[model samples]
Every structure is written in structure tokens, then in C-alpha cells.
Target: MMAFEFPGQYYEVIRGTLRDVHAETAYLADWLAKSGKATGGRVLDLGCGTGTTLRALAARGHGGVGVDASAAFIAWATEAGGDGLEYVRADLADLDVAEFATEEPFDLVVCLFATLNMVPPEALVPLLRQVRGRLAPGGHLVLDAAHLLGFVDTYQPSMIAHHQRDGVLLTRMVHTSVNGHTACWRNEETILARDPDGAVSMHENGFDQWVLTAPQIRGALAAAGFRVVAEHGGFRDAPPPPFGKGPLVQVAALDG
Candidate 1:
């Protein structure tokens, strides 16, 4: 796996600038509720960053385990403790479910915010299989990935964007490329923090992400012994969009 540069600072910047953490939390909670998967059961939030989803799940009366590879993220998440909520620091690609959910199976396992796109191609299916192994009977796995149509067909070249909030300035440059069936994204970011006394600090880091198509992703889930139960474009509960129309989400169940 490629090293993630400045993960802690990136999280902090985005949480304060580009993200409405509470809105996202509530939106996901509503999705689960509408899908009838909001039962107060054991839940695993794969690639959970800063425990945003887990906190919301716990509020819904569920037992939640939040796992991420970033120790900084886990540390921050741990500070937002709630009843029936826990955070684990580990790489999802090499996760050992037994080490965490030793006593029971998870009713719902979620990998959201295009998290699966970061998994190396060779390791994607194996990771899915591991997730499958930890699910309870009739349990559901929900994952989201960038849609090829949105990413490939509509590919845009390198561009720069900026965000500023609370005296912090974040500048991001994103480059997109497609090689055959794979899409590659490279992001370079620089952050500037200015203190009240005019002292300024700066940080910079970048990461690469590889993405696959909806069919490829669904095929991987099937290979991992999961059957697709429902799929949608973007976050809403609407019908799955046509290929290349929007970002995709898959809701699957362990195969018979």
C-alpha cells in the first residue's frame, strides 16, 4: 500500500473546512434506517475515519466498531466515545476480525466514501472475502465506489481547488488518468494555518488512488461469496443508475 502522507492534518483540515461531518452522519443514518438495517445490532464500519459513522450508529442504539489504518484517526475517534462504541487501529487489507469481533458477528459492515477505491487491485477481493467471513448470517455489506462513467468518461485533467475556514487555507491539486480498465487519481495538497498573532504554519502531502468499474467491483463481491441485494447511484435509496451515470453503492448479503 502506498503511504498516506499527512493523514492527520488532512483529516483535521477537511473536517473543519470541506466536510459537514454532522450532515454526513445523519444522512448515512437515514439511509440505514430506510433500508431496515438500523436495528441495534453489531456493526462494523470498515475504513471508518475518525469514527464519524460509528458515533451516529451508536446513537441509533447499535453496537459499533470503527476500524481504520491511521492511528491518528483512531486516536481522534476514541475521544468521541459513546456507549456500545469502540475504535480499532489497523489496516483493513490485513484485518483479523477475530481480534476485534471475537464474540459476535456484525449485522452490517460498511465501507463508504469511496474507501474501496484505495485497496490495491490484487488485494480487493481478498479483503472482501475477509469481510464476508466476519458477517453474521443474513448480514449485509454496504460499499461505495467511484463510478467509471463519472470517473473515466468524464475524466478531467489536473486542476486546483482551494478551501478556507477558521483561518486555515487548504489548496488541493488533483490529476486524473485512465489506463485501460483502471482509473488513477493523484492528489497533492498544501495547508496553511494562520494564528491570531499572524504566525503561519504550512504542511504538504499527497496520495494516489486507484479505482475500478461497477461491474468489476460487483464481480469481486460475488467472488467473495456475496450476493448483491440492492445497488444505487450516489447515496439516495433510488434505483441504481445506468453504468457511468454516477457514483455507485452496493448492498450485498453473504451467499447461500
Candidate 2:
């Protein structure tokens, strides 16, 4: 299996442009408040690439840690440090909550943007159990994952996007394929960077990702002692069949 890794600076710039950080932060805050959670509470962000979400939360008086397996990502996030945010380099599959013993239990744990889908099948349940153990009572776990319906409807087998800003140009190509319950993704990025001296540099990188189905994810959460409290299609609350036309966003709480 190919290990997943971020393609560094150029990719981050393009990704940041693609996502609306403020909107996502607002959605998270609103969801938590409506669920009866405090506004300025501790948050634990898993697969937090570059810590943008945590940084936004910090501005709202929230504090927390961001965890990712990418050393490059950790370094970048650490450099862009927030007032009360810390970045840790660690793999979620083998996460050690003991490392965070000094801090209070997290009020919210998030694995957004289909990050949970990247967890290997064998480690999915164990990771969920670990996450459950780290949450304070009444705390919630919010995550989004790929599902068959969504994948089929939205992501084409092959697609490309381009963006240019701040003397940098990025072209990203996405290829996807599904076999059984697993979806395989390959991302190819080409970057052209211009310098003040009228010189240009080019860089290229590729990454692979595998995603499982919504039922598989829900089952893992249940086996890890969580009960689904709310389900949504791309952040908006929706009725079940849960596997709608968008990513499966689930809010789960510890079960009795």
C-alpha cells in the first residue's frame, strides 16, 4: 500500500484556495453550539494539515492540538503557530493519548474533509476507540468520509484544476477508481514558482489515498462505543439513508 503524504507548499496553497476556512469554522462552531457544547472549548483536530482550522478556532477563544502524520505539514503548521495551538506529528492509527495527558480532555474531536477515509481498514476501529477515550463526557466526534453514492455522483474518474496567485501557479490532476468497498485516489500536482530575480522554478509531486464506504465507517464507530447523534450531507443536517449525494458527515457521542 502507498503511504499518503501531502505534496508540500504548492499543494497547500492550492488547497487553501479551494476551501473556505471561515465558512467551515463557522459551521463547526454552530454545530457544536446547537449540540449544547460550549463555544470556547478545547478541540482536537486529527489529520489537521497545516492547522488552519485550529488557527481559526483559536481566534474564537478555542484552544487545542493539531495532529498529523506528515512531518512537512507539522513543520509548516508549527511555523504558522497560533496563540493556544500546538501541532504534533503522529499517525492516528497508532496514536498515543498519553502524550496529551497534561492537557484536559478535548470537548470536540474533528476529522474533517474525509480524513478518516484514509485510515487503514484494520486500524479504523482502534483509532475510533482511542478518540472516544480522549473526549470529555458529552463531547462529540465529528467526521466526514467518502461513500459510494457521493463518490459516484461527484468525483469523476479523472479531473483537473488550476490556480495561480502570489507568483505561484499550481495545476492539480485527480484520478480515482473504485473496487469493492475501497476507492483509490491519485493526485498529481505541478507547480511553477516565480522569483523576484525573474527566475522560475518547477516542482511536481504525486500522492495516493484509499477510502472506504459510509457503512464501514458507521460500523467502526459503533464498535468503538459511539452512537450516531446526527448525520449530514456536506454539513447540512439530512435524513437517513445517510449516504446521500455528498460526503457523510456524522456527529457521534459516547454510548452508554
Work out the TM-score per prediction: 0.82, 0.84
Quality of model 1 by C-alpha lDDT: 0.72
lDDT of 1 by residue, 144-203 (tens): 776556566656767676766666565666554445555567655555555445667665
- CA deviation > 4 Å runs, candidate 1: 1-39, 153-157, 164-169, 175-183, 194-199
**Winner by lDDT:** 2
The alpha-carbon deviation from the true structure for residue 79 of candidate 1, after best TM-score superposition, in angstroms, is 1.8
Residue 49 lDDT (model 2): 88
Regions of model 2 farther than 4 Å from truth:
1-8, 34-37, 101-103, 154-158, 165-167, 175-183, 186-200, 237-243
Between which residue pairs do clashes occur in model 1?
149-244
Clashes by residue pair, model 2: none
What Cα-based lDDT does every candidate model obtain? 0.72, 0.74
Query: TM-score of model 1 relative to the true fold?
Result: 0.82
